[model samples]
Target: MSARRQRWEIRPPAPADVRERLGLPPLLATLLYQRGLLDPAAASAFLAADYATGLHDPFHMRGMAEAAARIAAAIDRGELMAVYGDFDVDGVTAVALLTQAIGAMGGRIRPYIPHRAREGYGLNNVAIGQLAADGVRLLITVDCGISNYAEVVEANRLGIDVIVTDHHHPPAELPPALAVVNPKQPDCAYPFKGLVGVGIAFKLIQALARYGKRPANLRGRDMLDLVALGTVADMGPLLDENRVLVRAGLIALNETARPGVRALMAAAGLAPGLIDSGAIAFALAPRLNAAGRLADARRAYELLLAGDRETADGLAAELNATNRERQALTRQLQARAEELVAQSGRAEQPLIVLASPEFNAGVIGLVAARIAETYHRPVVVIEQGGETSRGSARSIPGFSIIDIFDQCADLFVRYGGHAAAAGFTIATAQIPALEQRLLTLSRQYLRDDQLAPRLMIDAVLPLTELSWELYAGIQQLEPFGQGNPQPILMAPNVTAIDPQPTSDGAHLRMRVRAGNSVFEAIGFHFGRLAEALQRYPTIDLAYQLAVDEWNGQRRMRLLVRDFRRAGGARNGG
Candidate 1:
């Protein structure tokens, strides 16, 4: 099947004043302007994000002082504490980081990452009861517990003072924990609200080191690798403090001392010191997340805390194996999901929903994301459990999945997430009603022109503009994800030369030419259009610049984002 199409939006020219003041190439100046970094000083600061000066005071975050003090006192009193977290990469990294920080602070801490299959998400009352019985006097949550009101109350009743730290949007009725340190709390004054699960945990560690007994071994920067992993994996917007943290965290990740990190990198066929946010998101994070989706998340946490190379290597192998299994299962399930879409004749609907008893609860979110991308529509993949079911949703721009969930809140037993992604549990009998409500809401919010996804083009340039200097200028914006995306340059009416499918027939390797400038281009997922060389005499291409190193020789290459026949741009701004 042909992939979903996108509406291109090419940015207008940068202001002469701003461009002149910045003293950069036109392309560079425009890229900065597009990202809301117009001021030369601010643009300079962003490009050169530093650790010491870039970080905000954790105390500025509401409830941080109390949360830090309480945690410090627990350490001083040698209390048995449990760090409860979710099951995904962000949650596992947070738990591992906190566990290490507490241990280094002379505190007895136990890491608790809930099983994804058995316990859906968040801090469950059953887990709290078990921790209380395990002599846990203090409970600290990371990446979870903001919405876990009953669980926190149960912990409080059991004599376990609970401190909740999460990035998820808070409910109207907040948890009655002793202290809640979350940036998304309505009244919290934390400058950066984009901190992911592990980023918040890193901030807690910073507060502890500053206010409490500063341990010699527990430096906050040392644990930034975990922050980078979780932040990128969780798709946290890479802007402001998040950019700064990930910039420094990438350094820590490149020089990571953890045996498990090294082993994981090796398992992913990556070099030790070459990791960046892109690598974390695509290469490393999935392996860690696979453990949680398939088996226990604690394995991922344990891998991070591994002390020996042997153990780390073994765990990395197991995670890689699990990831392979996850890939095979996802491919199988995605085929079924596509069939469902065709059978329903709602492939063009505002929202696409696929439900089945055979759907694996662990991989529904992955399937939903893929389907949403392929159909250019909001997707909800449900795993029917006879009477009740779990559904994971992924949405395109201008549509909020969580907002739809809130509108249909009465139908869901529980639901929580941000705009782009969400999850819920609903009685299987109510699936029809939920679908109808979602479709209605989606139609009301989305227009016919807005059905397709938009591709934001950073700049329009000829192939002659591609140079080593321009590539270097682009590389300054390191650690790209979410808000801070890699730049996409477009070449109008370029000729496609020698386009051919790759070995797997999923992508295309080609050459593109504009005037006398010709460069190699690789179009991922463009294999279906294998007649690329002959189909179009000329094409307009949107792409990012990449370096292709072959036989130890480096040359500029084009990582094609999309292409179309000349002058075929769909509503470009």
Candidate 2:
């Protein structure tokens, strides 16, 4: 870990009366109150966000009625439809859910996922015209098409009506689709605006179930497994309706009999049980994404839609192999990008731009993300093709990459992304100008302090307060990700006991003691801190509680996030 002060923004103490009224442990109450669940009514609602009761009315979205009516008419008329999607996990699952739902509703829905390397992201006139020529009368875009102004016009000219069910931020001039269904639209009035592409697609399915023809057994709730997969994979905020969706979706996922899901879990080495957002994000999503990153994403889509275990298993193995290949490529590309930045003296710039004709376009995003995290700087990695260049950018906190790119949008062929991560395409001739403008924008938006990594500590506690009850209490805020993260607790003045590196010599396995309490703690990548452990007997440790299961037994373990010397000194990794 890079050297930096571990800033502890300790939560203010809640009123004693509120803790007593909630009948929660003081620590639990403090954590909850710090997360803005102070009042009893708000706290109750958050904890009790069940899917059945928590989902907003489908019609609450602005274009739901119109979109649903059009889809219903198509289903009634038996007009062929297509579900166009992007290449990421969110887009693939969105395509799967919408295709399955509409197909079950007696609509001829075919799935179309654009090639990441060839078609790039979002709608294209080539794919649009091809689908129209193939007799697709209606096009429903999931997770994309928010910025396909010209492509939507092409589809219209080809006599195809489009219902864009996306979650991306739309520009001022909306696509002239049949109905635009995105909560982020300025004129829209959706109660919850954090739905992923799959979440929005699920909402459309729910509306179709209510207003259109469907099989008696085609309950939209049954699709929560896919909803959970896509939502968690996309890193949507685990709050509001999203919390309800994920909470119930996890249940559905654990109990799902879908052969494709089962096979995927097996390939990922995930045991048959409950899975959290972490599992989806780290294990499942990566394997699914590998297909798109290194090969044809259609394999992943087909894996999800696979009917037999044999087919699903074969597809799962392919994805696993692709994921491994992607990992190797990422490591290789990261080294090259880092060396380029260092050798060219580009690391001193506020914005680091590394470009190479040899860089694989598919893995530039992953390389950019890794470099950005390592240096704690805004990074843009551009892959130069024969005539065009594609760039993926990752930003540190306080710097909005998409906003910065918007300031220089005229140089790009196309660009769209969120605050932190974005991708764009431009002609090779514009690379120098893009670099200059990006450096200028970064200087304007980033401060010196923002370049340093800062770990935010949620609360401070003594080891004596650690207990199974407290651990379980903190877990009430489960399904943590993005907007709501796993709480990081600080344990102060713990003496290191039996401090030693693990067998690999990359991590430290040790026992720490505070007063009369002793607990086993493992610090990942903390082997470099052996000298510091010997120098500073006492340290303040930041960690999140994790349950380690071994030999059919479960025990609480501390996964150390960061540590500092007890007396205001930097200590460990």
Question: What's the TM-score of each model vs. the native?
Answer: 0.97, 0.94
**Candidate 1 deviates by what RMSD?**
1.8
Maximum-lDDT candidate? 1
Question: Model 2, clash count?
Answer: 0
The residue pairs in collision within model 2 are none
Give Cα distance to truth, residue 167, candidate 2, Å: 1.4
lDDT comparing candidate 1 with the true structure: 0.88
Local accuracy of candidate 1 as per-residue lDDT tens digits, 354-376: 88998998999999999998888
Q: Write the per-residue lDDT of candidate 2 for residues 401-420, one digit (tens) a residue.
A: 98888888899998877777
Off by over 4 Å in 1: 1-4, 550-552, 569-573
Model 1 reaches what TM-score against the true structure? 0.97
For the record, the alpha-carbon RMSD of candidate 2 to the native fold, in angstroms, is 2.5
| Each prediction's whole-model lDDT (CA) | 0.88, 0.86
